[model samples]
Target: MNTPSQLLPPPPRPLLLLILDGFGERKERENNAVHLAHTPNLDSLFARYPSTLLGASGPDVGLPTGQIGNSEVGHLTIGAGRVMHTDICRIDQAITNGSFANSPVLQNLLHQAHNVHRELHIFGLVSDGKVHSALEHLFFLIERAASQAVAVVVHAFLDGRDVPPKSALKYIQALENKLEGKGRIGSISGRYYAMDRDHRWQRIHQAYQAIVHGQGMRFPTAIQGIKASYDTGKTDEFVEPFVVGTYQGVQAEGIGFHFNFRPDRARQLTEALAIQPFNRFPRTPLEHPPFPHYACMTTYDASFGLPIVFPKENPTDIFPEVIARHGLQQLRCAETEKYAHVTYFFNGGREKHFEREERILIPSPTGISTYDQQPAMSAPLIADAVIHAIESDRYDFILANFANPDMVGHTGILQAAIAAVESVDQAIGSIVNAAQAKNGAVIITSDHGNCELMLDAETGQPHTAHTLNPVPFLYIPIPTSHPLPPFRTGGKLCDIAPTLLTILGIEQPPIMTGLSLFVSS
Candidate 1:
């Protein structure tokens, strides 16, 4: 380690903090973005100071669920000025134990939301794949809401993006289980909505079908009408439903994998027969037949979409804006529009059940732009936001996420990551140019590392999946009338917040961990 430098006075300037997501690290290949980009501006930032990688641990990153490190932890640490270690699983456990208030970090969040009426709306990965939304996090949030008398509304963004498609109800059920019987905590009361329809009513497997279908014969769910649905057009296909597994090889036992939801529920309701199975199934047979099981049951609104904030996005779809204005009166992660992806957000196609994007591998010469999903480019809108933030006098931090890099990288899109990185570089050049005109101190860094720098474990080739490694942080000089920054920020995730507070002329309190490298020696 370098010698501890002499102590110096902190900079007395407003900081322009920019946290880039899924940036940093690159393989040695000649075609990757980090290796190919003509980034003199980035190189110059490197020459200006001491820097190190931020170990963006997916779990440590404090997502409500999941193993990937995304924005939830990155920004919260930067904003809260400390690492509270509020992992999603821990939050889940706390909810189970009814000890959430004991977690000072969560308590602070809820308390703060209560104080600001600043709606604490959580937008995250809703999956038991546990990518982001954990069963416990939602449970505790409800308990906290009920305790503080804060009205709660959940806008669940489904994650067939990571886990199995039909499994959405599993995580949802876990949340429901906790919320059950205990008044309104985690119940079906608050404005509950889901955004991913592709996973809405996914196909279930044989074993799962067996268990859930067994329950269906006894439950007999309430629906307007019901009818037998099968490919009875062909006489051979008209065989009894139990033979569905034999023909389809799905073990079509129980009220299991039915094609439609209305009939599926009708199959699930064992009791709707006026009384017997509904009443007797509950009391009569604990052992005579298979035990009752739930296939997929969740009470979520058909509405909810990612809140959009670009010219392209329909702002009226923002459910949080509605809740804060009319209901609970608080907000979290609410910003006008700085999302790295779509600039203009709408929820129209949210509920359509579609297959997950099939992961494909492309050799070095291939590119994603040449394949499907030109992947909606929010660049123009994001570029506009970056420029506006640079121009704004009160803006202290501007975070812009360029997703194709890391996202495409997950599909092993090497060339695509490189292109994505180049795009990011261009975005940076524009933002810096704008900042220079306004004389703001610009601080740029990425949350975790992915894309251009994949080291495959099997082939040792640059792999596609996210890797655990240190990512590069490029700090450009803010064109302030003041002198240049002597050194750049250092340490790790813990250090980012302190560095910003230093440049902002704010005193770094003890609660605010991480050392500020911007102070002069």
Candidate 2:
């Protein structure tokens, strides 16, 4: 096989990769945010540049055959240049094979709770969405605790973004049925409060108060809390924190376990619960004793000093590592909402930066209850950062994530999603103009699909969940003296890193099985 340098000419300087989050394509134009929005720049780019549809979901992005893609796996696959089995997939397999029940970390926590006669607190987002946390995993953990005769108390974090809006009741019922009156629900709150990644201490404190102090609105049952929220015109995501009947808070000596495998959202809460000298917010002191034993399904951060049932195997030879090895400078920029995706997940789950790598995080809009209210969230700001980096010529490669479509799309508001697509399109136009002035090429792609398919086919309700749709990959070589090769069609997200490396005249690493998308003669 011809090497990358042999196939391509010398690398172009100041390459910009603009990831339009949740941007996807489908034939149905009705209720499709991208189709409904006026995206002149994106339309012209597709017409003028080398564009093709790339598989972003399901097996193409290392998810199960029918499972939709998520930002974590999407960015991880893009950087790894190969299929990466996600934590959820591995945990599911372990459960099916009966290995999860025998995991040492889980066994130890259960034994501690059982032997000490302390309540075992199982806390995490309760959903079947398979994005952040899965309901089946919660059930498995609860069942395992029950077998050991350890009392289980569930702190349910409601999920409305990953699943349908107001679908928390179904999950609550499922959890109740699974318990069979064995374990009781302790407290309930929306993931917005419990799974915040943006260091929103106020929101985190609300969750902490509900879980640790049982200090929230009182409800006779989980169903009543959710029903009251619905009566007040609130969806699952905005459900106010509430405590269930006669529930005491998590005891200091209690064993706590968080089942959410994804680290980005789970990290803050875990730190608050498990870490000492907690100074992020004024943590209410526990009366009994803080978690005598605290563990998680997967490793969130090694610094958290918590035992993990399934520790992450960080990928080697990823995009950033290769770039640093070549002595090239690169910048990863995104708004706070997706800062991790552009850096952490994009670097194959490694939190540390490469030698020549720089990062910029634009704060996402604050004080908004939902992103739909501010549809054009931080895209213009992120685009400005990328443009400045490109114009400065300080970095060989620049990558920024436009978080409008995915973030606003989750709100299931059609008008807001349409506005978000337009905002990203405007931002891209500005960035592309700046790149062209500097003779820099711009590559546009998306991690997954969310805004494209707005309405559910059967229910016709707003489809808030991500779709199994293919995303667009457009490569625009701007005013270059050298002729660029045509991009190959039928590629996947994993092929992106190899394609970038091939364009930069860098050899593809042996560990990267994904083929480059550039057509070779």
Candidate 3:
């Protein structure tokens, strides 16, 4: 067998890997924000550099076939350098194989609630987004609870970002029909208040008050609560917390199950409900009754000390860990909104930073309800930080995420998305300029697609959800020293880590199954 170092040719030193979040490639011009944006820098790079489109959605990123990719799975696949099974895939497999119904974890929780004559509370986003939580998964849990004769109450978190803006009522009606008096909708709130991961304690406080104490705007039914929010010109995502009909709050000894498998947005609320002496934010006290016993569908945070029904088996020997083992100095930078993607998910779901790895988190735009108002959304600040790092020459490898395209794309505003794309293009131009000054190479790519397809082709309605389109991957060797190897086509997001390793003169670990795009067949 050949030694590890002999597997690939040597590469340029001090590389910069830039991830343009939610940027994708599409041929269609109409309603494509990326196509409409004045992105001369990106246009020039695509024309001049060695570039190829990489598959980012569905089975390409290890999600179920036909499922849209999310930042979590995208970054994880890039780091793992292989098609790793996602939480949704694993859960779906379990459900299909009947293991989910027979899970001891689920059975125990149901039995506990039934024996104690207490309510079983299920909380999660109500959508078919397949990014955070799926409505079908919620339905499965409810059906199981009803089978056990357990009293089930759903604290529905409305979703508009991943679906149509005014579609909450339709989902609510479907849920109501599914319940059919077997269970009840206890509370309704927008994900903006309930699923905040940005340390927006005030938002979390409102959700907590509404879900735990039944202390928000009251409505007799879930449908009325959503319709009232629509009357106020608010979409599903911004619906204020409200209680449904005389539903009492989660009581002591109650069993709580969080159905959101993805961990990022679920972390804060899980912490608030599970941790004792909860000090993350000021919380209203429950004087006599203690907090309910809680379990998550997957591990949100291992430190939270809660049981997980389907715990994630994190991948080993991922890209970052290999770099750390080689004693290479690395830097990870992103705005607050996507900091976890670059660090935690890119590190294979581990929050701990490796040796010789440095992280910088620029504060994302604050005090803004939506990113459309500030479409730039701190990309300039992130670019400045990245350019400064390139100049310092302190890191052998640097990675930064520009969150503009993805965050603003979710707002479903075409003009704002164009601005967001333009902003990232400008930032990429600056970073490339700085890298060239240092004789360094830069690889530009994206986690997934969101801003590319802005409007549905048939309906002409806003297409706020992630698309199945492929993302662009461009490799630029600063100053054009010598002829570089041609990149192979038909690549996937999993091919990125091995490609980066090949370009950095690092050996691809045997655990990684993805081939480097730089290698010819």
Candidate 4:
């Protein structure tokens, strides 16, 4: 039996790590967007190089058991090269142990609201999905607030990307049932309106108008609005803003509490909401003063300006400086939506730019309300950027992410998702060709899976969430002079950092829990 070992190889030429966001492998080829996509380049690479599956979900990636892996958890594990508890796990523990219920932040906010005679408005996702805010946690908070005779209102954003598409009504109704006497559902909107990261002001403006100004498409009930959204052919996540009757009647006065832990999906909306007295509607500025009495679940991005009482520690602090100590020049690029994942989460939640590291951001094409309309989202530009950076020989390492398959796959549009995968494949081909020209090795893998399993096995409907499926990891060596060894087995995301460090002739950090995948005979 072969045991896991830490062995370093001599540093070779330049190397690149390409992360394909939301790309996963599936057994059933039918309805598999990746398999359906025309990915000749990826196929050729898989055949030519050693490839293996990578575990990216649940405990394998440091998430709680049974919890599906997300971009945040996956990237953090890959960057830290260790198994660390994810944000969801932290939240889960807090709620389970009554820490969240009795948290000083919650108590102070509620006390401040009660003393000021202000209504406490809670805004967050209404799903039980762990990626976003959990309904149970929200309910527990509401229950505790109501116990103190504090009137509370909720602005629930529908989440179709993390849950089943078009299932917003089910969650909305369930929430309403729970809040029948304790609280009220003030507004209903899609995550798209409340969670654009690329500074999309229009969506934020619409959500602001609905929640604060009480001016938008008014719906008698959340279910009715969700039904209308389906009739209008909009996915649950992209549905237009709809204000519940109670919200229009009662102003968005008093202390507002935002409950999203992960900020990437909701960074822009949070930024817009921080602006006090938002009157310009669609013309809100990107940067503004923080909203009064507003607090977020975590302070992942301190610059966003929301007062956070429970901030998670950055895992990079525990990570050894392997790449930086080696004096490797690293260049990274990705579209706006995933720029943070490649930099922030991929650096184990570090915000500070590392020395000798360069990052390039390509603005995601705007004007399209939904990603499915423009399935090929900026992959070509990112690919071009990576190719230029690789061939420039200015950097010893290149890291890039193609955000198409993940962004488009969230729409659950079968053909569009396939096209997105194809676009990524073409980008990979360009990168591979560029690496060949520069005599550089390339590591291709994914953060998690979303496009591979296109349908729900039980319901036979389109499933728009990340899966527990394993991701593909392929490594192509430079020089192409010697035959590569057989691929190892049971690779996980954490193994990536150690493997890359080993290839660069750096000592494997003891903090890394994953073993290197490179095995020699």
lDDT of 4 by residue, 1-521 (tens): 33222232235567888999999999889879999989899989898788899999988987777778888888888888988877677887888888887788888888888887777888888786778677766877788888877888888898887988777887888888878777888888888888766676777778877877678888888888889889988877888888986576333334778887786765666655664545445432324433467777877467765567578676643233467777778887888888888888888777877888889999998888778999999998998888888878898878888888888888777999999999988888888888878888899999899999788888777888999999999988776566555668998998898778767766676667787787755
Q: Give per-model TM-scores.
A: 0.48, 0.96, 0.96, 0.93
Q: Model 3, 371-488: lDDT tens per residue?
A: 9999999999999999999999898899899998999999889999999999998999999989989888899999899999888676566888888989999988857556566778
Q: Supply the global lDDT for candidate 3.
A: 0.87
**After aligning candidate 4 to the native by TM-score, how far in Å is the CA of 84 from where it should be?**
1.9
On the 0 to 100 scale, the lDDT of residue 451 in model 4 is: 93
**Steric overlap count per candidate:** 35, 2, 0, 0
Ten-residue region with minimum lDDT total, candidate 3? 2-11
When summed lDDT is taken over every stretch of 10 residues in candidate 1, the lowest stretch is: 185-194
User: Per-model C-alpha lDDT, please?
Assistant: 0.39, 0.88, 0.87, 0.79
Clashing pairs in 3: none
How many steric overlaps does candidate 1 have?
Answer: 35
RMSD of each: 16.3, 1.8, 2.2, 2.8
lDDT of 2: 0.88
How far off is model 4, as Cα RMSD? 2.8
